[model samples]
Target: MGADPTAIVVGLGLPSDVGTGWLDDLTDGFRDECDLVGAGVAGGDTTRCDLVVISVTALGDLGGRAPVTRSGARPGDVVAVAGRLGHAAAGLALLESGHEGLPGPDGRRRDDPRRDDPRRDGRAEPYGSDERREDGVAGLVGAHRRPRPPYPCGPQAAALGATAMLDVSDGLLQDLGHVARASGVGIALDPGAFTVTPEMERVARLLAADPLDWVLTGGEDHALAATFPAEVRLPPAWTVVGRVTGGEGVQVSGRTVGQGGWDHFRM
Candidate 1:
């Protein structure tokens, strides 16, 4: 749990025309991350490929503590999340739908000089514009373009007796399902436990979608979701949302989720 990070072997695939900007960004990004986690750059390689791909292999020294793995979760463990969920999915939706004028930092439509913006007058103005991707509204697009995961939280959770842990690189329910399957347990998720940010609600209204669905199934936020013993007092970094039980698979609000999350093999 108190592992000191070692080298990071990164493999980059990209189009030659795209140049070194991505590589530079990757270098700087990994440097920042390594610095935060007490790691150093070892070496890496770059190659031209059809699409940009980054494979980061992180090696570390655990300082003699056993690794916290998914299989350790027990029936009585409490499920928790380290931070707000569903932000990345909402941001991607905005980008995919070409939504501009995204909710500002305050979760309100960015007030533009257009003056006649209907949302300003409390109307459900039609969404989908290129402007949201512009520099003016950076919150959503920023998440889509780059992720800011709480790295230090991992060690904290580990030291605090987290039984099982993983990054929310995929959707919450989808990732939790992995824990359930590996631990041979069931997870009961309470959607009401999540913090429904105004941006999620705004996106839901704009797309006529369910905010809970996004929160449960949206991916790429990189927040940590872990399981701890029932008696553990989780720090402020985490909030309880569910619990493990004797069963298989996962359920939300007492109903089985017929489908959840994304598969790289097939959408």
Candidate 2:
């Protein structure tokens, strides 16, 4: 749905061993992010737990506009996306390959990677040994840690008569599957429509991975995917990827894809 966020409520389950400085930094980061979208922290609750847990709820106003739902998509509508496609997933791959917090060419933390890698056992070697590779790796890693969602585009899409809309939080294929199932229609995507950034190509080459896999199945970028009438003139920020069809489920390049997205239960 297209709405303006106004406030956020947080709930923290922190460990007893955590330091006050750590709490201060966490709150400060929250404030900084909220400020970017003109939202404020309306207060929250905290409790002791064995591990750190954060829960956030955002409140928004639709400004008299009707809420866009996944079920509203219709056949012949064009499918488009606003913002990035697979930067976050590529970043996560770098972290898993043990390339977090690696210094840049200037020996600065400008390319620091954090938040996704868990194999911090000092056993994995860095992937980027040269300046060019290091810069590309850092850019991809930054995307994972600091995903910037296209906030304003949500409302703009709705204003342009979007029939269905959703954020690509759980992979493009997975999230769009929800829309397709809900709308009782099929979504046919064009793989060539997605751009394979140079950074992504470089990292994938080094890691022996497929860059297109990241674009199709990687999640957490928070890009907006919406369906609109074919005649609608979309803004430059939006890229047309596919179209809604008369059947059910989602396909890529006219063929059905396998299950390859993030699934908490499967993980």
Per-residue lDDT of candidate 2, residues 192-243 (tens digit): 8998888788778778888888887788778899999999999998999999
- Per-residue C-alpha lDDT of model 1 across residues 1-267, encoded as one tens digit per residue: 224567788888887777676556556667765665667878878898988788888887766788888888998999998854776677678777767565565667753433322223333222222124333334445555555566667777888898888888778888898888888899998878998776677777887767676678777778889999999998887899999989888888787655533322121
Off by over 4 Å in 1: 1-4, 14-18, 48-51, 103-137, 259-267
For all the candidates, what are their Cα RMSDs to the real structure?
8.6, 7.1
Best by TM-score: 2
Q: What is the TM-score of each candidate against the true structure?
A: 0.79, 0.85
Residue pairs with colliding backbones in model 2 are none
